[model samples]
Target: MKLYEMRDRQSFGFSAENPSGSKGGGTRGGDCEKLRPCIDIQPGETVTLCETQGPGMITHMWFTGYIGHSFILRAYWDGLEEPSVEAPVSAFFGCAYDENFADRDGNYPVLNSAMVLVAPGRGYNCYWEMPFHKSCKITMENRGAQAQTLFYMISGWHGAIPENSGYFHAAYRQEHPVQKGRSYTVIDGIKGKGCFVGLSLAAGMNGHNTCWVEGEAKMYLDGDRYPTMNYTGTEDYFGGAYAFGNDVYQHRYQTFSGLYTGLYAILGDTSDTYNHQKRFLLYRWHVKDPVYFDSDFRMVLDNLGWTGPRYDDYTTVAYWYLESPAPTPVKLPEDGEMVMK
Candidate 1:
């Protein structure tokens, strides 16, 4: 893997030709190197290396947070010159939060009432993939006074999908208003076998008190009816977890004769720890049917040990024929098993 490292004040230039001399006449010559685009990242900004590509181009990103403050990352491609994708600065899946105010530890069963953003002084992570464009972005922010750290990894995939496919699906830990209560949300205008399947746990008070829950949410395969998931409080599933910072995983799937996109997340949350609210993580994979069933998929959290939660949060995994030539096949483990870093 060819990985590029970027930090504050660092600028990378992409151009067409050499900048030394021009070809024609006395008019100071046109610099052969036509400037592609200048990715100007501010003090706390992260961006992709390049946006435009022929096809089958995948971009990967990894980020580490400093102190406890929140940061934002963005990616842009297609219609606009500027990157349009944004995400938070912490190791969590969505939004960013304080690193102090008590519930910051990685081991907590329930989140603090304030961290849920139910009232003032609370916020959630934001991630988006622009419609009609090949771009993605993540942003993180801490609404409190404390500082926090965050890590992230991003990748772009270049593959051909079946024709007639017009929708994309994604999964992530939904930040709710309470620790033990059940919350349900509706995904608007989606059709197909799309769903959210994963485990929810209460990371209680700095890894002290913790609990577990399991459930799944789904929508239709065609662009027809909307999909929804109902979380029950009795199931012991609440809040979210931090997996591998904020990550992006996209795959192409097929339904009957139509094609669709599937995206899901297994995330961790620590918004209700004892020290302060900070960090979120995610683990994701793209695979086909039999291979997916034989895969060992698991979720792991850092700093805090597993609190005996038996909920397996694996979303719907299926197969879809591609419209373009198949790329190199990447083999996945029979059983989905992931190790914590």
Candidate 2:
């Protein structure tokens, strides 16, 4: 019932030795403003980010770095070998393509929402409440060639978790040149009761086609033979209309960034290239309204385009909560398949 924070000021450990001592973290005797100054974030190694035995709920998380697809973040709940949450740190934070969405040029735009935010300083923040009954473990893996340093903070309350509380989960998936007559899986392998909370989708056209916004998203819940929930089109799912103002308007780009939904980023050249092979970063949060599921859940996105079926690259991050641990291990892609490029 009480709140606790684990940060570098406390030697990056959560110990409730004295309730009032945390305020002194950045003081003279404490570690001070010198937060985790990393010499190296080693490659091909899994570093334990946070581990705590006993029940607790992870309330907030923040991370900033030169994130790429090679950096993977994972969290295991209640001693489960398979991580309940797994995604590339970049994609998980709602940006993809192994690129920083923050810069002085204002080309790559940052997203701010109720559940997740990618800020101006390349900072990523999440307020998903993750409850664990037995233990919680978080880890980061650097799959890149060189060492990368970053700043991060994961703080939550440790004590008795609610009996009805569900465990938080997010998954990352990507498909290049989506196959013909098939839908892209956003998140699957879900079991037990849960509520779908949010989705982040990034896509890029494979060719110089202008009609790549006709795709629709679908949600399948609880053993449904077909999708129980369907969207009109991909742009509609992210609260946009009319090809995201791509076809009709002569402008270089049109975007919408709001509290619940964001058509945040559009990559295009202002010259003769037009919006060809344009890249986009979009997100939607189901905070005010959650999709409740009893037994299972699966989500998919259609690849149909206006000019006929089209193939495009798709990457997504799905956020949800489940009553029980996942039935099977959440296997991450192999090292060779993890690169974003």
TM-score of every model versus the real structure: 0.33, 0.85
Name the lDDT of candidate 2.
Answer: 0.74
Give the runs in model 1 whose Cα sits over 4 Å from its true position: 1-49, 65-69, 80-85, 89-176, 179-210, 214-286, 289-341
Model 2, residue 76: what's the lDDT?
92
Residue 17 lDDT in candidate 1: 24
Off by over 4 Å in 2: 1-35, 100-108, 247-252, 268-276, 327-330, 335-341
- Candidate 2: tens digits of C-alpha lDDT, residues 153-234: 7777666666888888888887876786688888887888889998898887776565677878899999999888889998
Clash counts per candidate, in order, are 76, 0
**Per-residue error (Å), model 2, residue 230:** 1.2
Q: Give residue 153's lDDT in candidate 2 (0 to 100).
A: 72
